[model samples]
Target: MLATIKNISVTYDGVGKSFSSGDFISGRITLELGKDCKIDYLSIKAKGKSEVRWTERHNNTTVIYHSKDKMFSIEQFIIREQKGQDCNVVAPGTHVYPFTIQIPQQAMPSSFKGAWGKILYTLEAKLSRSMRISSKARAEFPFVSKADLGSIPELMIPQHGTKVKKMKFFTSGKVGMDIHIERMGYYLGEDLNVVVSIENSSSREINKYTLYQKDSFFARGKRRVSTKDILKELGEPIPPSGKLKVTKVLKIHQHIVPSIFTCSNIKCEYRLKIVLDVPYARDPEIKLPLVILPATQTSGLQPPPYLTLGLTRRERKPTRMEQHTTISTAPGAYPPTAPGAYPPTAPGAYPPTAPGAYPPTAPGAFAPPPAYGMYPSLSDFGGKSEWEKR
Candidate 1:
């Protein structure tokens, strides 16, 4: 008699298959058997990782470069041996095991696929039985990291670029362009406003204006790039020595991938390119960096078990892998605190030298600055303090 495994699969609990940091992933594993089966163990695993691989040719040799980083991995057993009897034997029928896990709210890169690298998130289940090949099933899902928009103030500030080209051989003057945008970062499906000021002092007729977007991916010291025209506005055909100013609007593609900088071995970036078309003359151009934010904001999630303490904020030590990757794997991890807690300073307290200055004494010293610059007020960024209310 043979124990036959019919099928195995995994499914999530909710309709929103996409996930981000701090999200709770609830799912189940389904197994179908044709007959009674004796199994050693059954388990499920969830993992996220980034990998890069490419080769370079030098002289007569080919040098291969590759790297990988494991963002997170969680594994648990659904069925295993019991202290008593009959735990390893699964009777014929459809069996389901439910599970729930929370993704570590850490600074990991978003899921991406590039020419030479990719960041992937997957769920896998396995069934093992004596004297039988293990049966396995796997599924992939999209993951967008909770972008910390407020981390960099410049992301919210306006950007400007200027370019000038002096007509030398065929043309006999100079053409200058000034471009301005409201900000460097924008959410998907948002309209990007652009202002173009052109000063044409050349002998040729200015034709039209072209604006486009380009995506670039870098991996293992090599780069792959693609460009797509977003919008093109017809110029008024400025005659020699003419000036025209126009405002152009371009919509960010809803399905485009956002900018990625957290991955060490790979990077994804975007650029806005502005061009001036002139007859029989070299066109002048301008480029600006663009950052695309996720369409949906991160939802409020419950803090992990370890962060339930009454303390408003606390730091956890980093593991060996974290030190090298520079990516925090543990949720709620923070900068180290002073040896002991300092007493709260009196209202309107200062060093007596400058108004509203930080305390100078040991007992009244201000809280240590955050690991990064001007961030994590404990209440401003992540909705609530890690454990302030609880």
Candidate 2:
């Protein structure tokens, strides 16, 4: 139990949403040998292993996956012969480092709950002639959205025209495809303001229109978010068209997906399809798709699910509350001791009176003092006034 161990660690250069399975890790492990060295060979190695299991309810059958574990073990170096080296040389100190391990896309589970697995990577030092110490670094992995990880607006404005259907106009849009303005927000707590302009290029007075917004990521076949789903999140009625701007003000109450998962050289993308539902109807409920893809995922990352919170619009309560109060303490009774408060005064000192009326003489305001001085002045009978009375 009291053996010297090598230092080992695993880290990524990218942050939260950008963590990838293909990122590489590089580090070293050192071992120190004492006085007299080893009698056999020695080296360092890395091993990976994992197991997954699940039971389907449809048939009550358990599906077992035992070989899901992948390892990356390598013999750091073998020392077979050397001049009769000191213990430090024979059992000598050496380093056993590690390299990067790429995560397979198929292995990445969707972002849904109950679809997850754990992975472990370890490194150890082995010596044939003697017992040596070992060390390992472990990390937890979650399967993020596995689809619709790419694309943009170039698909919006079709060169010729937008597809018109049952109250819907669809297109990736010509210029709206790749607007790289950081100010366009989409994550939790972010307010997204977007404008997709369609100029009846057809010289027709489009009477009705409907729009549906989709999560860009959904394009790749992952999960997709529906405008209806977003509306549900809003809990209110939303405008359909003409000039409609969806301002999503964030209400941070719980786990609002704080980050995204990605690879080292990956850039995620979102897509939008403005469905001018009814050909001529001016305003109609429409749909747009938001997509997320890696810069390299041109083939595209799968998108999330189509979702909406079903939010509706309604008139706000008529007006502010009508406030009225009855004071328990007399008006201005206690004069403010601090700023904004009146100074303390006896109850009813200041009675309600018409504008120019004189003070009603606060009740008991003129209480006459007890009569005393008129009876006899102290100076008048100071010396011997008592003698005469005796």
Candidate 3:
């Protein structure tokens, strides 16, 4: 009689189940048998990949667009007998195999699942025996990648958009709106305070304002898009020749996935859209690219606590001059000659680092200029920062 397979399972070995690049994924595989069983081999495989597939129908014809990227795959043998030996026999009982694998240190997109595409990371174990189908168990885990906001100079730059529409058939005059944001990159849980100014010189009244986020997935030169409204406000009907200004604060949802642009087969992006409702005429709209970053990112580019957009002051990268020049502050150190002290440098050169440096500032007194892509001041948000409350 053949032994019966009781159970097969995989379990993680940590308080947190989520992992990131360069992090260890430690776990165990378990197997239980009812009686002594002859085992040929047992193995575990870990894989990360992205896939996108969709079909379009034309007149009596169908077109399919599909693509995939295998980010990584690893396999390890847990139970394998020597070539000269017969199949190994396993006594009836529960057995466990522990494992630890390190995720590759490279650019990888965060785990994502969409209607037309998905990026998945999973670990599976299998047991094979003579004259029996293999027993397999699989488990999925969440993975986050370092979205280096600091390196993307554009993320730190401020953005502005304006749209004006002149009414013709249903109304008269012109309606215009100007939208401004501090920066393009925002961490999860951060509030994006959008400042909007509206001028209604038209005969029709503006009734409402809607702000929403649009998510786009791109694969094989095709795109799938979805939209979710973040904030909706009723506008006190802006009479003709009226002007209004308002600030709307929208909190980035914690459950939303971070932006993914590293994967070529699949790309995920976000856009913030603002629209004004005008009766019987086209609405005025302003759209801006949005970059969503994880709050618990592992990238070494953590920004300072006070400022929302800039990099950390303590871990600030050294300037080019600081990196190439050396200074000896030891006791009785010989001061170099004037000509040699100040090395010929490129334009916009930082002050010399040698003895008698210009602007002889005190230690820790010279604060570096704030990096880009940070939140505005508290006053800009109308009071204490909402993020600081958390």
Q: Write one digit per residue (lDDT tens) for candidate 3, span 295-327.
A: 776432221111101111222332322222211
- Which has the better lDDT: candidate 2, or candidate 3? 3
What is the Å distance of residue 355 in model 3 from its true position? 49
Task: Tell me the spans in candidate 1 whose CA falls farther than 4 Å from its real position.
Answer: 1-3, 56-63, 83-85, 203-236, 298-390
| Candidates by TM-score, descending order | 1, 3, 2
Ranking 1 against 3 by lDDT, winner: 3
Which tens-of-lDDT digit does each residue in 311-364 have in candidate 2? Answer: 111211111121111111122221223232222232221222322111213231
lDDT of 1 by residue, 1-390 (tens): 554788888886554557886676666667778787766666667778888777789999998877787777755454543433554566677666555455655666678886767899888887777687889998787788666457767578787899888887777888988989998778888888888888889864543444454434445555555566655666556667988787877778777777665655555556677777766777877877777778776674442221111111112222222111111112222221222111123222222333323222233322322122222231221233221222
True-structure RMSD for candidate 1? 14.9
- Which candidate model has the greater TM-score, 1 or 2? 1
Give TM per candidate.
0.70, 0.30, 0.69
Which ten residues in a row are the worst by lDDT in model 1? Answer: 305-314
Sorting all predicted structures by lDDT, with the top scorer first, yields 3, 1, 2
Q: What is the C-alpha lDDT of each candidate?
A: 0.60, 0.27, 0.62
